[model samples]
Target: MRVQLFSDIASGAYAQKLLEIGEGLLGTDQDGMIPFTQQFCHAVESEDELIEKVFPNMQQNIVDENWLCERTILAPKNETITKIYKKILAEINTETSVYNSIDTVMSSDDTTNYPVEFLNSLELSGVPSHKLELKVGEPVLLMRNLDAPRLCNGTRLRVTELGRHIVKATILTGEAKGDNVIIPRIPIIPNNLPFNFKRLQFPLKVAFSMTINKSQGQTLKVAGIHLGTPCFSHGSNHSAKECRTPVRCSICKRTHHSLLHPKDANSSEENKTECVVNSSEAGKKQQQVLLATALVKTICRNGNEYSIRALLDQGSQASFVTESTVQYLGLKKTGFTSQIAGLGGN
Candidate 1:
């Protein structure tokens, strides 16, 4: 049941409502695995420098192995995984298996037939119609739940036989471990696309590594997380138990609640669970904070416009923009540039 709940959360069926509470402990109770993975990543970044000094035994775990360096990575959405798979394949200059999705043409009993170009132009389903690369020994993930125990959804697999019609994969996870399964073309309805339109394709995706959301119920002994942005899910960071050998965390400089040195007396319980947003009250507070904050906008007097993302710091007296933003916007400076003093008076 817990595993199913975790899978549901990963599917994002409970995203909006849960996301609201995800800023609180309720989200953690819903799905703790992804949050734990994220926290583990953050702790890795935070303990990078002090890892050797604070936890001598864990120092080697930092660079011992990296899974993200793999050629493929799994993600929650089929589209996302497809995109990542394509990108990695391109990066490695590897040849991918090209599979053209079947397009069914039908004329309604009372409706006129559409043109060939129009039918051809119609967008396909969630899965890509282009080349899909699958290599032997590379990790793969099942896109659908065909079997509960043997080849369930989100199951990790390794490619063994890539046939023209069927792709044979060995299960690398769960009770079906070491068992080989043949994957067949499955029907899939693309999200937000025409309801009547469907795509039939192999129910397999590359999974050399995966996004935190797609990593439900899977225990990761080692992880490599590249944070392009802040985690938006609940329990977005690693738990204290997961930080026994964290590798690269951004908060290493902060002496306050460093996870690397569990023996430290100053470490607060709250610090260890920074990603675990506990309590409805805390969730409400987070929403209120977001509501109160303003996104800064800039417009040239000449009617030139640009969109940008900026946080409104109510505590700060001065408004600021990054040099890159200014350059990108081509905003004219009213006067000579001056170095603004920060909190440290630099």
Candidate 2:
């Protein structure tokens, strides 16, 4: 009863194999790493080979919106993306248009605090750069959600014409595919920044190459991945569980992930000896464990202050103070009992 299929039988099987690889259903080598097979390696040996394979006739089909829409080059970092973009742009014999943004702080008096030079240098996520360089027939991706169903965010477009106030582009995907639209200079305020500032520029970036994260939800007929640097997160193609390579812990010299090693296991033998001391009254040796602690002043209900030592336990679900310190400061206590488990279910 399915109305349509997004992929063919061959592509569907290929995607299933990728899912199996990611889930660790496929067997690994002694190092716990997946062996590279020709069936799975749809890769090129060099960047030139990749670019030529992805875009066969760069100059001829550079202005073809349909051709550009079906292909993209994905990289792990923005710097690699920029390099790919410049390489692709250089192949096309067209005049480049440089559009500089008018950046200003929200507060007029705070202009000195955040200069235009500083703002121009910043390259925040989900925001276009201060200098937007483009050329006619070049593909650009929308950065903001301007108009849903027509010019929404992530919508790929090809530049038809460039202007000082606005740029004319044709939509390459969705229901409005092949439809021409105007992109104007909009005030973009990055929400992730600490201060408020406005960047007045066209919300578009060169889509000849883009970061892998930005390529999510996008289906391309031809795609090239630039692995100049190793991906640091699970979102980009691979996860830690899918890794077949064995790792060694630096702290304990154990054959496991370094992050799984205990923080206190790095203590020297001398430090361990100092922890054990003989008690004068009981004449028995007692071991004292060191924990992270912080000294702070606490104010009670009567406005009286008392200095208290607080243990910093990142694994704890709730904060706790000693009963003697609470009673001495005349602080109200809430009675709530909860079962807690530690290492080895203790």
Candidate 3:
């Protein structure tokens, strides 16, 4: 029997692709062997065929939730594997918790001094006094100025309730010995630092944005995207004014920037997942020879323009974008670019 399948446009096209493989399994001969024949394909080919081949249990997992019978993550009573796992976790903790200092000052009053440039505004953005402890930043450095040090990009800090005052440091430059003193609502201590610098070094959380195109080949549970309402798809298509940039809808635009990058696929953990919000239709394009969808995770943004392309794989090696589609879209090329492994480009 011969099966000719066209790519179906449905809400669950991806899931249906999986189901196709399940149906193909019924065609095995008595020997249970697939014919060893290969066909030349185009630039954007879905690997549903091979995907189905590798996942024989997918048939079982498709309907049976109990078969998922998960294994326990709990460490066995003295298993060497547990020790190794814990050791690695401790090592990582040690590495990440160890923050460095450009200079060390050992004064009788337990105070360290920093240059004027080492300071930046300590903006907890105004944490209410009652909930101050709820804030995550650990004031690692007692900067002499209000400005944050350029080098302290990843440092986390929490200021003490009082002593942050009296820690005098110069905030001015030139021949004048400026008598500017730094004042904080609180003194500071580092929590992540080990017992050695536990009172100083700090760690803080920071947020970053990535485009949908850069995330193509990746699988994230949830992602945050910034699809503005006036996307490339906005305005009326009936006007026929030659060309148009698609704009996103109200639902896609209002999502917070932090929610645009998804962290995982359809995993059980929902709370820790990442979220994706649509950015402008700047990423989508139609190609005759290649059918693609932006790898929501692999997309990246440097400045004005972001990169978007379908991962030409069903969880294979790489991500891709067509040169022809990009040119037609009239987007600026970023200075730094990398090649997608399977993307057919010069």
Candidate 4:
């Protein structure tokens, strides 16, 4: 069997426009159709515009400026993405404003405890420390699967009450809607690590904005994406049933790879070539083709493990299995389906 190993294809506005029409046909066949959701993202800009400008536009208008700000959750792909969030927070936390951290307390379950140094070396599965910033009415995303049906990972919530010890929140969207629940620090073990590390922290994180990689397997009614560079991954910018209108940077009119676009492309090209004699930069480099295979173990819901042939693709954000493999393993379905598109158009 010839299987494509973690390949990627690019798409522009034209390809996406056709996809919207195709999904529209499918929606028309279904009587109860949900309206298409609009999402925005920039391919080469930090999330500062998203946090400072785009988010505020979506907030509900309040008469009192002194009142608590609208609730929001912020999500980053990694620690590196959090720099922008921290920067925005620093500016807001002036002499006239205040911010605080809700620290998590770690306690051992049994009377016999491990040494402080040994325990200190352990790192949690999610957030490292228990420290969190809380703002009343802000939205939050559950980071771990606590209750699969009611409060699973990716569940949305709104903060109602906060403290140094615990948080009181109300479920915003799910079967547990309107349900008030107290969030506490919980112990977790990191996966695929040599050491049996364990730590306690709240199984939650911000969600107002998240990386495109993390957004996979999710359906968004409204989304704002901040693109810092061209997405080199498959399906990074594709979505179903929604028309995308490129919002060019007000400062730079061009879209592709731009922090700022030149006023005239033709003019800039001439000037760029002129500077080539003075700037002795090396020529462009070639990309190497990478291929690797492995025999990997897959565990099913019933706990049956199978060793199967798999591709070792570091670039892929998710793993995929064939329909036949799923049937052979008798894996149970979660009943959730996502439509994935590529250059060949499906």
Candidate 1 — which residues are off by over 4 angstroms?
Answer: 1-84, 90-95, 105-131, 190-194, 229-346
List, residue by residue over 242-300, the lDDT tens digit for candidate 4: 43547443443423212212232335444321111212235633222223556688786
Ranking by TM-score: 2, 4, 1, 3
Writing each residue's lDDT as its tens digit, candidate 2 over 1-346 gives 0011123455445645654564567888998667766676676789988899999899998867778999999887888888888888889898999999999899888888999899999888778888888999999999876776577667899999998899999999777898999999999887667789999999999998888778754668888888877766556555546555565445554443333222233467543322244344465544333344556898888998878888754223345667898788897877888764432233
User: Pick by lDDT: which candidate is best?
Assistant: 2
Local distance difference test, candidate 4: 0.48
Worst 10 residues of 3 by lDDT: 126-135
TM-score of 1: 0.42
Point to the candidate with the largest TM-score: 2
* Model 3 Cα lDDT, one tens digit per residue, 1-346: 0112223343234333333333353244677533422331112233233223322344234222222111111111212222322332332212232222222223333333433233222222111111111111112222212233321221112222223222222322212223343333332332332221112212221111122322222222222222232223444322212323354223333222222222223535643323233333555432212224443333223334444554342223232347775564554667666543222211
Using Cα atoms with residue i matched to residue i, what is each candidate's TM-score against the true structure? 0.42, 0.64, 0.16, 0.46
TM-score, candidate 3, is: 0.16
Q: Could you tell me how far off, in angstroms, the CA of residue 334 lies in candidate 3 after the best superposition?
A: 27
lDDT (C-alpha) at residue 125 in model 2: 72
- lDDT of each residue in 1-346, candidate 1, tens digit only: 0121222333334332333332343434454433543322333353233222222332232122233222233234444545444544443323456555554433253123543344445544324342456765556777666766566666677777678888887777676677878888776655554433445667666664456555645544443443434455666464434344333433554212322212223457655322232353445321111212234556755677766777633223346778898787777778766544332132
Better of 2 and 3 by TM-score: 2
